[model samples]
Target chain A: MDLLPFFQQLEATTVGRVVRESLWMFPVIECVHLLALALLGGAVLLVDLRLLGFGLVNQPVDLLARKADPWLLAAWMVIIATGIPMFLSEATKCYYSPPFFYKIGLLVIASVYTFTYRRRVTRELAYGRAPLTACASLALWFGVGFAGRWIAFY
Target chain B: MNFSAFVQWLDATPGSVALRESMLGYPMIETMHVLTLCLFLGMIALVDLRLLGLGFQSIPVSEVAGRLLPIGLAGFVLMAVSGALLFYSGPIRAYGNIFFRIKMALIMLTGINALVFHYTIYKRVASWDRDPIPPLRARLAGLCSLVLWSAVVVCGRMQAYNWFEKAPGA
Candidate 1:
């Protein structure tokens, strides 16, 4: 189904108007969004490194991943909160952007991988290894970031 | 001998020419630069926040720093390589960019702040390594790192926008 109508309605809201009309506000939100993206990407990669048999080896892989999980999740929350207003402000532009869709797709795949197979494998490191999963996780999340950045290029 | 001459030489370099002319090379390098930056910030925030008494209190600051350092260093190394490539791709424009100048200045300030911390209170960190609230200087160092890096990220991000423009010379 077409989503432009929903985007249009959201953009008509007071918050959306402020986000769209105020030059500084959009940039401010953008700054927050970008920082959150970086934090999230970093946190995720740190955990991924553990899965790849590197980084944070002083502690158990599970512990490292668990400890870093909160920051990863917190940054994700901030990104989503800040992102919505920016998206609402330029809903149509984003809706038409290919890279935006790529970002979303990669985000979904990365999150799923994080919550499922990646978590299981890291939890049970004795049962063989999942270096391929680690590699894919890195590519997927970083891909989301790259695609998100690409949205601005267009 | 002069900065302009150096920039001119860089612009004429073969690798730089390919970076600018290739369809995917510049974008791919830019992507890596940004992603590495994100990873670096993430690792920095973990240690800095603990020092600032904000987050991750369960673990000792030293342990947190120890664990994240290698990954952070890797990110920094990769970013340096990608960043040099980016600047080399368009030496004149990068040198002329106001935001690029701010970014460099902030990076220098951050380096100095870290150096001072390492040389001073951080050397005697054993006593307060596990303290929930760090000593005044340690807290100040952490606060400075956060603010300085925040500014650096903003300046770096803004470099791609309108504030950057090409000058006739470097």
Candidate 2:
């Protein structure tokens, strides 16, 4: 589709103007983005490993999940918050980049898994092992991270 | 060789040359570096929070640490390898960076803190494993590690930009 005008319009906005004009703003936001990703991914993988029966097997699943879940949600919020301004600054470039779409797609899939399959599967300890859900979570989240880095290259 | 000489050597090494030259080499290694942090930092957080009596209190501290150590170490190994490749690919910028030095220092200090915890206070873990609140030393180590690791993350991220790039022989 010829949606280039929409992205160009976004780049003309005040928020986009600030991000593009200020040399330090982009890298500052990027640093925060990476830090938030570290926290979010770390929390997600820790819980997923337990779900896969790899680590923390003998521990109560819900208890550990409870501890990590807060950090995960908070960091997710930060990632989006920081990511938006960066995307807006270079809206046209990101819109045309294949890796940006790939990253967004994986992020959506991973978020769905987190809210649905993961939540249900890890809800009760008596559900035995659900390696499939755990595996999917790992793959989806890691895929999002990988694609995010690829945005810089491709 | 001096520091610059060592860095020059790393930059010229065959593997480093390939990583720097190949289009996908740097990004791929960076992807692995970020991915591995999930295991290294994520696994440690679970056990550290337990030691601090903030998480997984229902489980014994030793068990939490015991189960998570292997996986965390595996992540650390992968992280170190990938991190080395990243550094080797662009040693000039990396070596002159202040944040890089801070990250290295934090890594060394955090490692020593872990070693001390393991050999000493952790030896008496049996007595306090289920205490809900671990011994003062164990909790101190946990807190220190968490803070240090977080700082390292920020430093590593900051080093991505050239904010601290110095002048030539100034």
Candidate 3:
């Protein structure tokens, strides 16, 4: 099906025009997007690395997780808020891009993995045992990062 | 030495041709690069912020650094691999491209800065571990890290716009 026509029509609308004509908007939002990603990535890294017995070997894992959790959530909020508008600006291109599709898929999976498995991982870390869940979380987040990069190329 | 000639030579290499032809190669590499960049920047910020006495004030700086380092390394691996692929895809253009060169230089500087921080300041300041305020040297390193990484990101974003020019009738 010819999707360009639909996109063109959308681009003509007030909301669409804002998306299309807001040239200055995307770059500003992109800056924020990167900043937010840094926050989120940083928080996850701190907790995950501790789980692997890399750093903070003396501290309790649960405490580290609790300490970093708020920053992670806040960063996630910034990422989503800025990301949605950027997505809207080039909805058609992203919708049709395979890399973009994979990025979105990875994002969803990562989110689910974080929310469901994080608690269990924290428990294991607190007990001073090797946590498989933490490893898995790191792997999943790595996948998310990889897929996100793929999106730019596609 | 003429850097432009080196760039031209790199572009003309057979490997460049092979890189460009690989299916989904360029995009895949680019994607990985961005992903790693995110990781690198994110982890660095967290560590530096800790050094500056921001979040995780209760936790020992060494502990936070220890935990965050691996994640940063993982991200670094992704970036290095992906970045190499990107360079391979269009060696000449990327080599000649000012932004790409600047980004590369900054990345190297960032590495040096990191090593220096680890060797000189980290142990001395982190010996106190529980001191809410880190040593001045550590704080200086932290500020530098923040600035250098920000420059890396800006240079990376600028890469898309800086294309190499072709010689006429070559």
Best candidate (score: TM-score):
2
Q: Can you write out model 2's per-residue Cα lDDT over A82-153, one digit (the tens) per residue?
A: 999999999998888899999999999899889777886677654267778779988898888888888878
Instruction: Please give the range of 10 consecutive residues that has the lowest summed lDDT in model 2 chain B.
Output: B161-170
Relative to the true structure, candidate 2 reaches a TM of 0.90
Candidate achieving higher lDDT, 1 or 3: 1
Measured with C-alpha atoms, the lDDT of residue A116 in candidate 2 is 78
Write one digit per residue (lDDT tens) for candidate 3, span B1-170.
48777767777788888778877766666666666665777777888888888778897887767767776777778777777778877877677678887988998898898899888877575476777778888888888888888877767776775234455665
Between prediction 2 and prediction 3, which has the larger TM-score? 2
Candidate 3 lDDT over A48-108, as tens digits, reads: 7667776566778888788788888898889888877777677777766786778778788
Clashes of each: 0, 0, 4
True contacts kept of each: 0.66, 0.66, 0.66
RMSD after Cα superposition, model 3 = 4.0
Give me the runs in candidate 2 sitting further than 4 Å from their true place. A60-63, A125-127, B166-170
- Which predicted model would earn the best lDDT? 2
The Cα error of candidate 3 at residue A94, in Å, is: 2.5
The Cα error of candidate 2 at residue A80, in Å, is 2.1
List the candidates ranked by lDDT, beginning with the highest.
Answer: 2, 1, 3
- Per-residue lDDT of candidate 2, residues B1-170 (tens digit): 89899988887778877888888778888888987887888777767788888876778888889988888899899999999889988897788889999999999999999999999999988889899889899999999988888788878878887755765785
lDDT of 1 by residue, A28-137 (tens): 78888878887787777766776677656565666666767788889989998998898888878887888998988888888888878877776766423467877998
TM-score of chain A of each: 0.89, 0.93, 0.85
For each candidate in turn, give its C-alpha RMSD to the true structure in angstroms: 3.6, 2.4, 4.0
